[model samples]
Target: MKNLKALLAVPAAFGAVLAVSGNAVAAESLVEENLVESVAVESVAVEAADTVEAADVMVAEPIQLAQVTSVSELSDVRASDWAFTALQRLVEEYGCLEGYPDRTFRGNRAMTRYEFAAGLNACLDVVIQLIGGGDLTDVRRLQEEFAAELATIRGRTDLLEADVAELEANQFSTTTKLRGQVDAHLVVPFGEADGEVPLLDDDGNQATDPDGTPLTTRDTLEEADATFEYRARLNFDTSFTGEDRLRLRLQASDSASSLVNAGGLASQSGRRNGFEDNIGLDDVYYSFPIGNRISGIIAANSIVTDDFVTSTIVPYDGPAVADVSGPVFYDQFAGGNFGAGVNFAFTDNLVLDLGYSSEASNVNTDDGGIFEEYSYIAQLNFLTDGLFNAAVTYIDGESDELDTPDYTIAGLLNLDFGRVEVGGHYAYSPSDDGDQDSYGLGVTVPDLFGAGNQLGLYGTILPDDEDEPLVVEAYYQLGLNEYFSITPAVIYADNDSGDDSENIYGALRATFNF
Candidate 1:
C-alpha cells in the first residue's frame, strides 16, 4: 500500500523535524533562521500533493486567512526581532499563523515558491488537525523538496479555471452594462452657394412662398445636399446599489444640419439630429443616492437641463459646432420629455440644481399632462479644485403651444490654463414678443497636436427674436485611439442682412467608442 505508507511516515518525519528544529533555535537573526527553515520546507511540499488528483483540477479559492492571535497582530511583525519567538509559537500555539486580509505580515518581501507553497499548505492543515494522525513523512519530505513549486501551482491553477469558465460564459450583464456611440457626419455647404437667401421663421421673420415668393436660400441649398449623416448610441448602464444608476438609451439617427437649410444658418450640427432613422428609446434615467449631500434624477425619457447640472461650465460642451454648442437659451428654455432632478452638495465647491421637464410628460389630454408643456430649472453650481468653473441658471417655460410664458437667464464659464481652455455662455429669454438673446465664446487647445488632440475656437450670437445670427466656429479633434475620433469643422453664418448676408460650412466628424 504505497510501500506501507512509506514505512509509517518515518515517525511522522521524526516529529516534524523536531518541531522545525525547535522553531529554528528560537530565531533571533541568522535571517530569522533562514525564514523558519524556508517556511517549514515549503509547507511540507504543499501537503504532499494532498492525496493527488488532477484531471480537470481547478484549485483556486484560497484567501481567507485571518487567524493570527499575536505575532503582535502582525502589522509588519515585530517585537524587537527576527521571528519574534518563532511567530509567537506559530501564532499562539498552532493556530496555524495567518495574516493579510490587509492585516499584513509581509515580513520584508520576496516569497513565492508558489507563495511558499501556499503558506506551507496552510500550516499543514493546521498541523494535521493538531497532531492526531500525521505520517506523510513530513509530507514525503516536502514532496521531494517542492516538486517544481507544486507543478507551477498546478499549472497556474488550471489556467485560472479556464479563464473563469470563459468569463462566466461570455458575460454581458450581471447587472447591465453596454455602452456605445457612433456619429459619422459629413456635411458641406459653402458660402452663399449661389444667392437667393431668405426663408426664415421661428421668429427670424421672412418666410414667403405661397406664391408670395421670398422663401429661398437657393431653394434650401438646392434641397439640402452634400450630406452623409449618421448617429447611433446604446448605453444601458444599470446597477442595483453600488450607489445607483439606471440609464437606458438606444437610438439611431439621420443627423442633418448642413447648415440646417441655410436661412440664418442653424447649426448645433442639428443637435444630435432627428431620430427618423428608427431605433428608439433614446434615454430613460434613474440615478440615485440621497443622504450624503443628496442626488437624484428620474427622467423616464430624454430629459435635459444638462441632466440636472453640476457643471455646464462649458468647454464647447463637448467639442463644438455652430451654435457654440450650448446656451441657445438653454436649448430654447431647458429641455423636456419628462423629468425630475436634484443635486445639492453645497460645498466641495458648491452645487444646487433642481429641475422638471415635460413636453407633455407622456401626454394625456387636458392640454396634455404634467403641467402642460412645462420646463423649470434652477442652478448655481461653482466647483473648483483648480481650473475654475461656474454656472447660474433659471428657466421656467410653458407653451400651450407657445401662448407665452418664457423666462430664462443663464450663465456659465470655465477657465483652465495649462494649454488653454476659456469657455463662456450667457442666455436670456424674456419674451413679450422680443427679448431673446444668446452668447458664446470659446477657445480650447488641449494637447493640440497629439495626446487626444483638440483645438476649437468659437463665437456666437444665435438665439434671435429677429436678427441675431452671427456665428463662427472652428474645430480639430483627432483622437484616433481609445476608440476613435476625427472632427474637422468650420462654420461662419452672418445674416446681419445688408446684401448677400453670409454663410459657410464644412464638417467631417467620425467618432466611434464602444
Candidate 2:
C-alpha cells in the first residue's frame, strides 16, 4: 500500500518540480485536446510495481486543457486560489504549463494523460539541465514515456517563432506614419441684398468695372450659386530622434471662392474655402528640441501665427464657419508664410513664444525677399492646473499687398467645466486710418447627444473700420463613428455700414479621418 501511494504521488511530485523551473517556450505550443488519463497512471503503476506492494491504479477522467503563455493570462487563476502559487511558479516562473489561447486556465477541469505527459516532460528537461544530466532512473523512464508528445510540442514552438519573424520582416515603416483627412462641403446662400456694392481690389481700394463704372459685390453674389466643394489632405509625419518631428502635408481642394462678401472682413467668408482645385504641398516643417525647456520649428512653407502660440484658447477655432473661428485681428499680420518659431517654457504652466515670417521668402524677384514683407510675433501663454487658461500676444509686420504696417495686440481666454466650455478673444490693431478692434465670444457643449457630438454658438465683431461687421454662427457636429462626422451650421452677418447688406448662409460639411 505504501508503494502504491508513492506511485500515486508521482504526478504531484512532477507538478512540484515544474513550479521551480523558469519560463518555458514549448508550453505556448501545447494543443488543446482530451485523451485517456489511464495511459500515464498505468505507466506509473508498472514502473513502481517492482519496488513496492501491488495496488489498484485510479484513472482520472479525460478533460479539456488549454495553452497559455503566463499564469496571469488565465482569467480563472486568481491570487486567492489554493493552487495559485503552484500554477504561477509553473507557468510564470518556469513556463512548464500555459493557459488556453482564449486566456482561460480551466483549473476545475480534469486533466488527460497527454496534458500530464506534456507538462511532466517540460519540467524534466529543465531538471536534467540543472542537475548536469545526473537525473535518477525514474526521471529517465518518464522522459522516454512522453518523448513523442514532447517532440510535437517542440515542433509547434518552432513554427510560432518562424511566424513572428516573418511578421516583423513585412511590417510597415518604422519611423514614419501616414494620416489623412477629407472634407466635403455643401454651401447654400440666401437673403443676398439687391443692387451692386462696389468691388474692392486686393488692396481694399475700389476697382472700376469693365464699362468704367465701379465694380460691386452684386456682380459676385448675383452670379454665386449653391456649390459643393471638397478638400483632401495626406500627411506624412516622420520622427528621427523619437522626440522631433518632420511633417509634410499634400493638399488638394476646389473651394477658392466665398458665397458671401462681408465688406472687408474676409474671415467671414470662411478660411477653409480657398484651394482653387490645385494639388500642391500645403505645409512642410521640421520641429526639434533646442534644450530641456526650449523647442524650435523651421517651416519651409505655410507658416501661420497659430504655429507660434501654444494655444488659441477658442473652442470654435476648428469647427466654426465664420469670423468666430478666430479673432479677426490675428489675420492682420498672420497669413500663411515661410517662417520659424521657438517656444521657451518658464514653468510647467507658463511659456513664451516668438516667431518671424515673410510673405515673399520663396520668391526670387528684386521686390521679393525675406525682409521685404515680414512679421514678428511674441506671445505669453498661461496654463493652470484649474479649468482656466489664457494667452496674450503682440504682432508687428508690414504687408506690401495691403500696403500697410501692422501692429496688433491680442488676448485669448477659455474656461472649461467638463462638458461645458466658454472661450473669448479680443484683438486690437492700430492703423494710420484708425485703431481696429475685433472680438468674439463662444460657448461649446461637448458630448451633448453622445460621445464625440458637440454644439457650438459664436458671435464676433470683425475688424473693419467701415463695416465693423457682426457675424453670428451656430453649428452642431454629429459623430457617426471614430472616422466620420457631419456638421450643419448657420451663419448670419450684418455690418454697421447699414446698406441693409445682411446675409445668411447655411452649410453642411462631411469629414472623414484616418
Candidate that would win on TM-score: 2
lDDT of 2 at 218: 46
TM-score of 2: 0.63
Runs of candidate 1 with Cα error greater than 4 angstroms are: 1-133, 136-183, 186-220, 229-257, 260-325, 328-347, 351-380, 383-390, 393-409, 412-436, 439-461, 465-510
Supply every candidate's count of residue pairs whose N, Cα or C atoms clash at under 3 angstroms. Answer: 2, 9
Clashing residue pairs in candidate 1 (N, C-alpha, C atoms within 3 angstroms): 43-120, 365-368
TM-score list, all predictions: 0.26, 0.63
> lDDT values of the candidates?
0.64, 0.68
Report how far residue 239 has shifted in candidate 2, in Å: 1.1
* lDDT: worst 10-residue window of model 2: 54-63
* Tens digits of lDDT, candidate 2, 118-234: 567766554544444445566678799999999999999999999989977876677888999988777787776544554443223344544556544444364468777777888
Off by over 4 Å in 2: 1-172, 194-224, 262-275, 334-337, 403-405
